[model samples]
Target: MTKKGKKGPSVTAKAEDRHWHGKRVKARAAKNASRTGSKTLGPRKPGSSRAGAAQGRAAERSSGATRRPDAPELVHGRNPVLEALREGVPGTTLYYMADSDERVREAIKIAADRGIPLLECGKPELDRLTDRAVHQGLALQVKPYRYAHPDDLLQGTAPLIVALDGVTDARNLGAIVRSASAFGASGILLPERRSAGVNAGAWKTSAGTLANMPVARCTNLTRQLKAYQDAGCFVAGLDAHGGSSIANIPAADGPFVLVVGSEGKGLSRLVTDHCDLLAHIPMFGHAESLNAGVAAGIALYELARQRHT
Candidate 1:
């Protein structure tokens, strides 16, 4: 029954009806959120595969490894993304963007003409993926990162390598990488722990140097340097107070690797002992020491200068 101002139903019955209605509204909102979140990363949008989706959700909830690299991942940048699109096309080439007719647009056209999918998004979402990157408003979705061995870098080239002892800082690593790339180095080696790996900032600092440089993660540094020694690459350690001035080293005895230790501590004793030479940059001014990155640049340039002549 209805009233002018209030319903005439029993209080218990009214409460039960209100509760049921609330659940229905909540269920509809939840269903929409679930559906909207099902989009794939790049251009490939899949229809809701409910049966498999439920199983995949269950596996994720249990923290299992159903997580496959099943779909290609997105890479954002002008050069790296370009490299992936140009090199990765045979398998799958899909480029996505929000803004068209810019560099991003050009990349999109390239991908589309190459038979790759090109998807669009609103400006807000594209910015979020790149974190305000200078993507030229472009990003390419492709396969995972593939690592190569140290020897690969030395293919038909001289042996010049940089071994990062414990440089955990990404900027330092990146800056050092720029130096390494300019100096005609072959590869870079870092320990698995207490060292930095490739991330966004490092990539930016590397400035496409990463694309050319071969990097390897060693399980054990002490053992790995020995391997380089066995391969006939003389190892040199850089220190603030070291034995020899880097300039004096003649170019005739060539093909070497340089080891730079952590910023605070110049060199771990173990790593320094293994080096065939310990060289220092002569800081004439009052500054006690140089930044790990700056020192690395000087050292690398010294090596490069020696080799060029």
Candidate 2:
């Protein structure tokens, strides 16, 4: 007889190997699940094949992985899109569906006049572009805002700067920018994180003031404050509980940076520590605190008055 071919592993040995491999896979999956807090682990059962995918999607959404912070903003709705175009909010593209309302037609005309490219798409495409927001067959893709440098705001002999700390609301940011422009602020300073950037809401709320206002973003608000201080600018933070009123700050006459915090939390501890002084807006009413935008406006008006006087 011919030499017997090398026998393959018996069925019993093959089954044992498969059992150990499955156990190792399950062990590794369990370890990963424990670390990630994910309930779906290991190879999913045939009956629940979609469960793992569903869980992964949920995780991504919860972590904000789907948000594109750098993407060009899409201003939706006929009225809003038309207003943005009218306000000269720089835009790259105008997307719309046919048979739109008068507002949409007006937006298209403005976009054409401004030389912004127009893309006529279907309702489904509009819906996708606007993330299913109420687009009303209109959407304008706004150009990404260009932020100024913190040093750029240090222009003029006595430059006035408005810095926001933890002011997350885009509307509040817009309102602050409006006030800053009115009060002769050199520019607006925002921390790179935990602060609102100039977006569609801010553009609407600013009433087009953003077109003129130069906004800057910094990596560290505290370090920026120190730098401002070194540059002979007084850094005053707005706080509900402070030693002195904002109007009474002695450094109001010189170059100043007015740091405004969120309406609810006031200022963060780190920011407060870094400030040269903490000032409160004096109020006679029983109200606890003013809105961040309102408070910033009041403080800025006071500072402007000081400078003129």
Highest lDDT scorer? 2
For candidate 1, what is the lDDT? Answer: 0.58
| TM value for model 2 | 0.70
Q: State how far residue 257 of model 1 sits from its true place (Å).
A: 0.5
lDDT of 2 by residue, 219-250 (tens): 88898787776666767777665555677776
Per-model C-alpha RMSD = 28.1, 23.0
* TM-score per model over all chains: 0.62, 0.70
- Poorest stretch of ten by lDDT in candidate 2: 36-45
Residue-wise C-alpha lDDT for candidate 1, range 1-36, written one tens digit per residue:
111232111222221233233432333233213221
In model 1, the worst 10-residue window by lDDT is 35-44
Check candidate 1 and list the clashing pairs. Answer: none
